[model samples]
Target: MSSEEQDPDYRFTLANERTFLAWIRTALALIAGGIAVVQFVPEFGIPGTRHGLSIVLTAGGGVLAALAVRRWQRVQAAMRRNEELPATRVPMLLGGGIFVVTLIVLVILVIWPPVGQ
Candidate 1:
């Protein structure tokens, strides 16, 4: 890489760093949510439903956390090299994962109809 390309504009680098932090925060939130669900939330009517949900949320968070680092590195490298930034499936995957989780909760709620409902 060219000497100039080795260190691109500071603004872009800072922005990339911010994005990485945001993803990390999101992952942390997911992990915390998983813990909260398992600890505080009452069990669903179906066996293992609560634990299953917790596992999915926690695992998704772990995956996102790992992917975020990779994404940060890839973006930083591309920025330094002045190459086109790579596209990512992170948003799509996160959305889909959340959607599936929501569906699971919804199905459980409908089938079990939580207490007093």
Candidate 2:
């Protein structure tokens, strides 16, 4: 093993990597959900709503994936330097973003009319 890997707590480093991977998986799931919603869901009463939701979801997922990379890098660097973990704003930001998206989706669902012949 290199000098870098030999230093610091292996368990903590591995845990951090695991957390990063989990976030990436979450982002992938979000991307898949975006595609699924766009492809599988019927159009809403308002024209273009399905497209809007799909765009929003896909964009959010992309942004989150980028954030995951950034967060992982920052944490890894801090660990190498033996510094305290950086303040974690990513989780709060993600939660707030998803909350807003859910509210918007729920509103759209309520407004959407039934699809019938």
Candidate 3:
């Protein structure tokens, strides 16, 4: 076999691995955040908002994680063939958007609670 074909570094497999790990970490953080919000924050009488926020956060994290895994695989395949990396800005934008929206929702929940009868 040729040197380039034998040398793994000739491709971007390492980059793909790093990207996959990053997504996993991001997913874990999101899961933790959701659990904390739902399980712990409620102890302080913030249960109502926390519960809803937890669901949203958890789902968001899951979606991000799934997307990340798929993207990683696609990128890895592209790299192996010496093709350009696929556009990833959309996922980044979506993830960011979810995070910002969640933050805003949490803030609103904290500042103006629901009408508690």
Clashes of each: 0, 0, 0
Candidate 2: the clashing residue pairs are none
Question: Which runs in model 1 stand beyond 4 Å of their true positions?
Answer: 1-4, 115-117
Instruction: Estimate the overall C-alpha local distance difference test score of candidate 2.
Output: 0.82
Q: Candidate 3, residues 1-117: lDDT per residue as tens digits?
A: 433333336446777788788888888887788898766653323456667678777887898788888998777666556567788774667668778876777677677654462
Q: Score each candidate by Cα lDDT.
A: 0.90, 0.82, 0.71
Query: For model 1, which pairs clash?
Result: none
Better lDDT candidate (1, 3): 1
1-117: candidate 1 lDDT, tens digit per residue: 667677879999999999999999999999999999899988788878888888888988999999999999999999898899999989998998899889889988988965554
RMSD of each: 1.8, 2.8, 4.5
Mark the 10 consecutive residues where model 2 has the least summed lDDT: 1-10
Q: What is the lDDT of residue 66 in candidate 1?
A: 98
Better of 1 and 3 by TM-score: 1
Better of 2 and 3 by lDDT: 2
Please report how far candidate 2 places residue 102 from its true position, in Å: 1.4
Worst 10 residues of 1 by lDDT: 108-117
Error of 2 at 106 (Å): 1.6
Prediction 3 global C-alpha lDDT: 0.71
Candidate 2's residue-wise lDDT over 29-83, tens digit each?
8889889988998877778887888888888789889989898888888888777
